[model samples]
Target: MSGFASWIGGALGWTLGGPIGAAIGFAIGAAVDKATSKGLLLEPPKRGSQQRRKRVDPVYEKRRRRKTVREKQAQTKSGDFEVSLLVLSAIVMKVDGEVSESEKDFVRNYFTKMYGKQRANHAFKLFNGLLKKEDISTRQICQQIQMYMDHSSRLQLLHYLFGVTKADGHVDESEVDLIEKIAGYLYINDRDFQSIKAMFYNPVDSAYKILEIDKSATNNEIKKAYRKMAKKFHPDKLEHLGEEHMKGANEKFQKVQKAYEQLQKERGF
Candidate 1:
């Protein structure tokens, strides 16, 4: 009875526990055999148990995906703003054919006021760098501007460009031509453009009046009147309004140019 009990105890320990229990039983059997020449003890081995499976939390996975999407959106918006600012700056500088120091100063000052000093400086540097490329087309610049900037922002940028052209206190005919070309590229209509023109360039100036030529006016009087109107409606002096109002100025200036041109052609001057 005692031997059966010992055998059953050894089997239970080895099966329910692990290799350590089996080794301990074998050691005891070895010691007993050396003392009394008995056979070694044996027990059945236990089957290995499987490990517990890990669970994936759905909430954690969703949060990780959301974070990734937000990061991508931020990168896209940053790239777009940088490209838009660069193209707009280039168009403004090119409007007058030769970018004057006064124009550059005005751009710098305006941007510094609108954005911070550091951002303004960076934007100007980028614009200058882009302008150095000999093969770049104006259309390509406009396309980039269109891609990244909104409608209202583009209009505001156009206003700033006109402001730059007028920074020297005089708007040359070449400057007006350039502004018109840029406006066309921006898809601004003739009527709307004229509206902006009127806001900036007054058509009621004496030169326009001389173009109508009062019957009593002498040649000297006409010439003097032309000079006075030319100074006033030159497209550089009109101010104190937003770009939407400036559209009227543009229209007024176009009429002034046309009338002046017509008078010169008739007078053979």
Candidate 2:
């Protein structure tokens, strides 16, 4: 835990406060509880809580306090995105009552592909602790994300969540409702939400939904919507996160292309 605390300084400069901090700290404490029960939390717990916060680093605290508001919300680190994904994934995995092996494997494969074995193992450990947690507030977590994360990253969060729910072969209504609620809290509008949500489902009209267009729209409208949607889901939008992270964004981008081609074939324009 000592080494982990030092690492947190750079990795989680902005996410180390608010409900997201509490949730991550609590999950770590839960996973840590098995090995030892007397360590301090990542952040302060409630007034009457059994756990306590470790002593603050005087120099670090002073420096943090001096940071300007703009500096605090600085670029969202890749670590921030991974931690946020862990917390949100924990919430969605438990939404349908049972946490199946497939969902676990989905998460495992996801991080393993993006971050390799060690990090994926660490993520699953944290995710397991979060599942055992009972008081997670989806709204509060999303609100915290809204305050710090960029729209492209937030949209990626939504994309992975929909995939998680469907990992077990079918997405339950309850799961959809929870993911949709998370989207709304993250300030993702209805059309944008539907467009991403459509990537997983395979209904007759899914292509239109993926492009965020109505079935009744004109041929030119479909072309315009395709151009607009294509840019919105472009891989370059998330290039700041590095090339590895672009894979997921690219998946969404490809879906937009497929949807556009389908529309073009149908409309013959």
What is the TM-score of each predicted model, taking all chains together? 0.43, 0.83
- In model 2, which runs have C-alpha deviations exceeding 4 angstroms? 1-10, 30-74
lDDT of 2: 0.81
Deviation in angstroms for 121 in model 1? Answer: 1.6
Model 2 C-alpha lDDT per residue in residues 181-239, reported as the tens digit of each score: 99999999999999898888877899999988889999988889989998899999888
lDDT of 1 at 203: 64
Which segments of model 1 are wrong by more than 4 Å?
1-85, 95-97, 205-269
